[model samples]
Target: MLSIYIHIPFCVRKCLYCDFLSFPASERDKEIYAAALLKEIETEAFRYEERLVDTVFLGGGTPSILQTAHIEKIMDTLKNCYRFSSKPEITIEVNPCTVDKEKLSRYKAAGINRLSIGAQSVQDSELRALGRIHNAADFFAAFHMAREAGFDNINVDLMSALPGQTAERYLETLLKVTGLKPEHISAYSLIIEEGTPFFDMYGEKEGENGVERGLPSEEEERRMYEETGKRLEEAGYCRYEISNYALKGRECRHNTTYWRRHDYAGFGLGASSMVENVRWKNTARMQTYLDAYGKGKIHGNVKEEIQRLGRAEQMEEFMFLGLRLTEGVSRAEFFEAFHEDMEKIYGPVLQQLLDNGLIDTGERVKLTSYGRDVSNYVMAQFLF
Candidate 1:
């Protein structure tokens, strides 16, 4: 089954710590961009006509900012262009400040069954530090509004290791979020990305402010991650991925397609697509995207980057991505895919890691607690 991703690259304002390809909204640009997105989808539909889409995810700068009619038009185009699975999982990412009861209801009517709200943190201070437009109350109101609008499958995004954030505060935020009982929780550690305001204001100006004004240290971040896993487990949420927790049967299908290396289609500015073992991305420039579409130049947006993966690269990706799961990569599946036993390929490394108490092997190869703590280092060992 295939998955579809639509990027909406407009937000009210950029977050201080965000380096995503997005811009502030403009009426003229929004109108042009939406039309271009529709055109891009139509142009690429023929390529995936034989495939069935199991998941449809509308992600963005802020998909919730679009008008209901615009969203509906996009959905209508998708329905006309592609065949969906009998029980497709459709999701849309929303910013709390951009949505209300009416918009949420319209989104549901447009065939979006899942909502992923960007509620980075529920603390006002943390929100301000991250340069978020909405406060904690706004997020709560949006969540309630989404529920009222008949959305049952909901995901909330949270962040740990924020500037000036303490472990106590992080735990408190986690407790408050779990109290809401969302179906999915995505907790990511803050990364001070280059080109972001936060990186310039704090990261680049190192030594200007005390440690309290910067991101949490590696040790503290690791503690927060381990504690999060423990807390979420206690709350009946399974760690399906390193940073993603879900109630049983609530794992995100679209994201799973990615980790599993399945084919998918992406439309809109800066959206990346993987089809027929070929991966490509659209231009990130909004004006360029609109101009090309207006000139009936749909193919102009696509940049063919990786045509296919070699055996070594594929194996490396398979192990790394699969290891992100708590259950880890299945030895049987690896052999089936590669026609070689994983143990045979990396026997010495596996034995060494096991001897070092970094990995466990049974039906599958998985990182132990220590390995999980230093997953990046462990993954690097498998790379060719």
Candidate 2:
């Protein structure tokens, strides 16, 4: 089975820390972009007629910013072009400030069954520091509106290690999120990407006046990750992946398909797709995408750069992606896929990690508390 990702690359205003390929919306551009997206969908549907699609995710610059009619148009286009499974999981990413009760109701009616709300933090000051427009009250209102609109499956996105975040504040934010009782929670550590405003401000201001302007220290970040796992699990939210927690059977099938190396198609400007062992991306510029689509440029900006997976790449990816799961990879599944014994492939590294109390291996190999704290390092050892 395959999953589909539709990129809505339009936002009301770009956030300070965001470096994604998106721009503020204009009436003409929105119409043009939506049409181009449908065209690309048609192109992809014809290209991959053999695969069954089970999940569809609409991520972006904040899909909530779109009007109900625009969303319905996209869904209608999908129905016309491709076949969806009986019960496909259709998810849309929403920002708190952009959604209202009416819009939420219309979204459910438009066939969106899942909502991923962007609630970075509950604290107003923290939200401002992160350059988010909404306050905590707005997020609460949006969450209630989603429930009122018949959305039972909801995911909340939270960020840790902000510019002025403290351990106590971060814990408070997590507790508040858990109190809301979402089905899924994705907690990510803030990374200051190079071109973003946060990066420029913090990167230039550091060490000038004893300023601590960047991300949290390595030690602090590790502590935050460890505490996050412990707290979420205690709240009855299982840590299915390093950065994600969910109740039973609530794991995101779309994202899991990627981690498991399943085929998927992506549409929109700057979107990437992996199908039939070939990976390619669309052009990033809006004008370029529209021009190519309007001119019947079927393979515009597409390049097939195929890298056949050898033993090392496959094994390394399996270990890295599998270890992201708290339950870890199954020994039977590993051997079935690779035709090699897991114990024979990297026995020394596993033994070293297990001996150091960083991982546990019984039925399935999983990260111990120490291992989760230093997961990147543990994953790095398996890369070669």
Candidate 3:
């Protein structure tokens, strides 16, 4: 089986803290891009005809911003080109206020079974500070609209550790979301990426004056993170992955396929795909991609940064990615895939991690609570 990711890299407005590959586009530009995407999907379908596609994720710069007809056409084309499984989980990522009840109802008719709403923060002040186009009331409207439109499987995306955000305030946001009890919740801490506005205000160069500038202190940030896990768990949502929580049976299967190192294809600008140990990413340049499709060259000319993983690389990935799950990596499955005993290869490293109380080992190996707190350092240990 395989999963498919379709990227729609257009948004109404770029947020201040976002560094994703997204931008504002005109309606004409969107029409042109959608045509190119359809051509690419048809072109790439032949190679994966033998596999059954079980999940389709429409992600990126607010897919819900598009006209309902565009989304319906895209889904129709996918159903035509690929052989899907008996029950496919089709999801679309939406921003509040970008979609109305009518648009959401059309999406349901088009076979979209899941909705991921980008409700970063519920506080109006925080939403404005982050430069979000939607306010708190818009999020509530969107959620209720989705329910009225018949979407039961929904995921709400939340973020913590914002500038001027306190732990108590973070809990307030958490409790408000938990009250709704969406099937899934993804809570992430804000990271100051180099190219975003938040970086200029809070990056290390200005760290000496950070506290005066309203950025949360390290103690407050850590407390916020701890509180997120505690509050979400108390609400009966299980933390199946570091940043993702779900009320049983709602974990995102597409994302889990990525963590388990399964074969999946990505379509659209700057999307990445990995299959049978070979990986490639589509060109990020918009006009370059359009020109390729114009010239009837969607297959080869549009692909870039292709690499084939060697055995060592595969083993490294098996450990690094699989360990991210709360259940950890399976030893028997590791041996079955690599044809070697995992202990024979990384016994010393495992022993060190075990001794340091960073990981626990049983039939499967997984991070301890403290280990997950410092997951970056723990995951880095798997690199060769």
Candidate 4:
């Protein structure tokens, strides 16, 4: 089975902390992009026609920003072009301000089984700081509307360590979101990427005595991260992945495909694809992409940065990616895929990690809580 990701690069406005490939566009620009996206999907389907699609993730600059007809057309195109599994999981990323009950209801009709609402915080001040177009009240209304629109499996996206945010304030946001009992939650810490407004405000600034200004200190950020697992588990959610919590049987299947290194195809501007160990990304240049698809030349010039993974590189990916899960990598599966015993490849490294109490060894090797705190370091050890 294969998974598919479609990117929608339109938004009402850009958020200060965001560096994603998204921007506000006119209706005509959206219409043009949608047309090109449809053609690309149609052209690509010929290559993966035999593969059964199990999951479809519509990610974006707020996919909910699209008109209902546009979204319906896109879903229709996908349904007609691909052979889907018996019950496919289709998810769309939504901005609270962009969706209403009618829009959400149409989404359900379009076979979108899951909703991922981006509610970064439940504080109006934080929302304003992030330059989010919606307030806390708007998120509540959107959630209620989604539930009313018949979406049972939903995920709420939250962020901690925001500008002027404290652990107590983050905890309150968590409690408020959990009170609604969404099936899944994704909580991420803020990262100040270069070129983003946040990079200038927080990334470059140094507070008194070498402290960071306008954001939570590293100590408080650590507290927020640690408390996330504890509090979510207390609220009946399981931390299946490092940054994701979900109720039993409600984890995101689409994202799981990525962590498991399964084959997935991405469509639209700046989309990426991996199939049969070969990976490539679509051209990020919007005009270039549109022109290629518009002219019906879907092959060579559309793709850039293609690479086929060698055996060692594939093994490294399998190790590091799978380790992100709480259950970690399976020794048996690794041997099955690579035909090499896990212990034989890195027995010494494993021994050191075991001695340091960073990992638990057995049929399935998993990180200790301490190891997860330093996951980058632990994952780096697998690189050969």
**Highest TM-score, which number?**
3
Per-residue lDDT tens digits for candidate 3, residues 214-246, read 878878888999988999999999999999999
- Candidate 3 RMSD to the real structure: 1.3
CA RMSD, predictions in order: 2.0, 2.5, 1.3, 1.6
Model 3 is weakest, by summed lDDT over 10 consecutive residues, at 202-211
Residue 330 accuracy (lDDT) in model 1: 93
Model 1 — TM-score against the truth?
0.95
Q: State the displacement of the C-alpha of residue 295, model 4, in Å, after optimal TM-score superposition.
A: 6.3
lDDT of 1 by residue, 309-377 (tens): 778888888888888888889999999999999988989988998999989998899998888878898
Cα deviation of 216 in candidate 4 (Å)? Answer: 1.1
lDDT for model 4:
0.91
Query: What's the distance in Å from true for residue 50, model 4?
Result: 1.1
Worst 10 residues of 2 by lDDT: 204-213
236-312 per-residue lDDT for model 2 (tens digits): 89878888999888998888877777778888888877775556777777777887675455545432344556667
How far off is residue 162 in model 1, in Å?
A: 1.2
After TM-score superposition, what is the CA distance of residue 349 in candidate 4 from its true location, in Å? 1.7
What is the TM-score of each predicted model, taking all chains together?
A: 0.95, 0.91, 0.98, 0.97
lDDT (10s digit) by residue, model 4, range 267-361:
99998899989999988889998888765555535888999999998998998899899889999999999999999987988999999988999
Mark the regions of model 2 whose C-alpha exceeds 4 Å error after superposition. Answer: 204-211, 214-223, 295-311
